[model samples]
Target: MNLETFTLFNFWSSPLLATTAEAESSSLILAGVLLSLAVIYLASKAGGELCARINLPPVLGELVFGVMVGVSVLHLLMFAEAGEDGSHSLIMNLLQATSPMGSTTFSHVFEAQSEVLSVLAEIGVVVLLFEIGLESDLKELLKVGIQSTVVAVIGVITPFVLGTTGLMLLFGTPAIPAIFAGAALTATSIGITAKVLAEMQRLNTREGQIIVGAAVIDDVLGIIVLAVVAGLARDGQVVVSDVVYLVISAAAFFIGAIWIGRLLNPLFVQLVNHMRTRGQVLLSALFFALILSYISATIHLEAILGAFAAGLVLAETEKREELQRQVAPVADVLMPVFFVIVGARTDISVLNPFVPENREGLIMASFLIVVAIVGKVLTGLGVFGQPGINRLAIGVGMVPRGEVGLVFAAIGAATGALSDALNAAIIVMVILTTFLAPPLLRWAFSLSEESATTDPASLSGNISEPVLVESERLQSELVKPEIQ
Candidate 1:
């Protein structure tokens, strides 16, 4: 064949070759993601079962196991945001071991798989918040006498002030790092708290309601504070209009979602009730959550907030019990993924004192940990005029830093606002605070068993009959699996 004819023939063949490579690459990515999920599910179940046998929260076990298999050790499921590529993940290595793929091709697969997993993790958390919302008593939270609001306000202000001032004064740290770390302290992980409360059958308790409500409110405030600090870090000064916009938008979105959802609930019920299709209630609720979640994300708020608002709105309807039943199985599948991811992303090697560079971060961490704990613990004192309430329980309930703190730390690191030492300190603080809160909460309530254990038959008026019934249902459901 002549040169022109030969070149055209090769060009036609090249497209087919490229298509085959693309399909193969896609398959590799899918395989990596599947293997990563297998690791996550296995780790979560094994950890959860062990914890259940040992009287600890199953989520904590999931977290611990996640840490073990994560960057700190097994390196099976680390994230790309943490600056690791395919070589860092054992899962990728295993896939390569099996398939004998080229290094470049496998690296691409690992990165793409990580991105997919990250998105799945985000959806998992959204499902978790939605589930918590379904279980919470929005009416009770409203009538809980403003304690949640007060605690949330105090929870934010106290930690920000204490952590910032303490970091600056004690360690002589610079303003940006100090402020970032301080803002990090304001985070209260509702995901972790809600899981513990549900496990303890305390979701309907006064303290549990107060903690859940405060955590939700704190989540809104945390986003605002993160924005403000992020602005101040990037620019020399905070933009008043920007902060005002965030505050106004957050308030409006949350309130507006609930109000509008209530107006639409009758129509929602009718639509679902009329559907003869399977998964009617579950799918409808998820659709509502995802739409609100999208709106919330567009407004620069957390998608979890919208999912929560969706849950709160639906919880007020007659179909709540049915919805809860349908959502439970789905939750059982997705919720552990969130917990596992949070744990997996955590790098505990920062806390190791044997390293010379870690000494400075360790000292700084000691200070931040104290501030993180004390600042949140002081939120209990804000429980004004309520006699016989376990203020310690209320305060301790807000202590865990969890994923929210990690977000602040990650942002600060990304913006170059936090130094290596400060970032390490923040990581350590998040890790320890998350580890302590569940046990501390259990202990705080344990001291005053008079309210529980003995079971006062007349906890009426303040707690609605529906709440009590829900609480009893949760307790019973803990032991027995429902049969179809």
Candidate 2:
């Protein structure tokens, strides 16, 4: 029963007791991949449920579970070296090894599988962004455009400066890692913030509108920064002309995508709606998103950006609700995969305070967390000139970095621009900000409510009410033609 002496036919005839090395190795790897998916989905769902029970975002639980099962804890998905005599390692055997695949072969297989999972995870984020765009009202967004832009600008600038300066001064880290730290800190996860706001029944509030609007603007700005930093990292130096080119290209892509998408949306919708097929509209919507995503990637911007723009185009159509309904199921399946992948990528070892080797990383993480918090808090002040607004609530609402921050950190790590220690620190900061924002925001809104309730005179200069009315009017006008 020597594996080296057996033919492929004999190995295929009895897969479990395969005698051919190639057949056995391939079968084992396939089984491992299937098992890994099962484990990841189950762990992610369980963790999400646990977090929900504790009144926290389910993503937190999913991420923590991923860390638990990943290399940092259970070592279930990590690839380790083979044993002596070129045999399969203990993990491979435990997962049901059929033959010895040397460490190199196993490593290659594992890496390939990981890349596949990563692609799936990225698609999940794209779907999530598309959904966000679908739910958004572009008209309302424009009403708060000025305020949102200011808040977004300040939010990006303050965090970037603080993150870069703090890392250089406190940790004496190299410039690339410091820049990445700053970039990571600039991400504000609108999904998490919007969910919390909706749960608290404040999504229609002025502060809520401002927070959501600002987050959307922040996303666009953050992507541009990421593109610039990635370019600088690749070239190993920031050429002034190169920086200008990157900035212009990014700007042109975003503006052009939105403008062209808007111009063509009506015609596209009309064409899709005229179709007699049952699900033609939904299919067309998905195709549109995928095509835009492809275009974004082709132009060197993130695909998610194109997906978001596609959603925006579809959002303006009369079939927006129908499109959203059809896409929801797909998003649900893939989005969790993205979050879990992010969690699995996080290395818990560097965050262990008890480990002497991790003490510096732990200290650096602590400092970054502080900076992340304070920097976003200052963004609340950008709401100046608007009365009766709880700036604190707005700022707190903007604090959670969530999936967007994770994406930035993942990019940095993948590019080798961020070291393990720095990546760990960024993740810690992301986790803390995400974990703390919900309760803090709830408390801030409560204070605002109490103040408004206790004093009738406190509403003298409230502008949100009038703006809300105007927003309602604008929405009515936009929907009037469809209603007819």
Top TM-score prediction, candidate number? 1
TM-scores of all predicted structures:
0.92, 0.77
| Runs with alpha carbons beyond 4 Å of true place in candidate 2 | 1-30, 78-105, 167-180, 190-209, 226-236, 402-424, 438-484
Q: Candidate 2 overall Cα lDDT vs. reference?
A: 0.77
lDDT of 1 by residue, 1-484 (tens): 9999999999999999889888998988898888888899999999999988987778888999988888888999978777887687888878787877886787678779989988988898899889889998888978773989999999999989998998889889898889989999999999898889988888888888899899989998999999989988888688899889989999999999999999999999999989999999889999999999999999998999999899999999999999999988888888878888888999988888999999999999998899889999999998877777889988888999898999999999988899999999999999999988877887888876866545555455446888888999998887576631
State the displacement of the C-alpha of residue 151, model 2, in Å, after optimal TM-score superposition. 1.6
lDDT of each: 0.89, 0.77
Q: For residues 171-235, what per-residue lDDT tens digits would candidate 2 score against the true structure? A: 88998889988988999987667766755767657787788878877877887788777766677
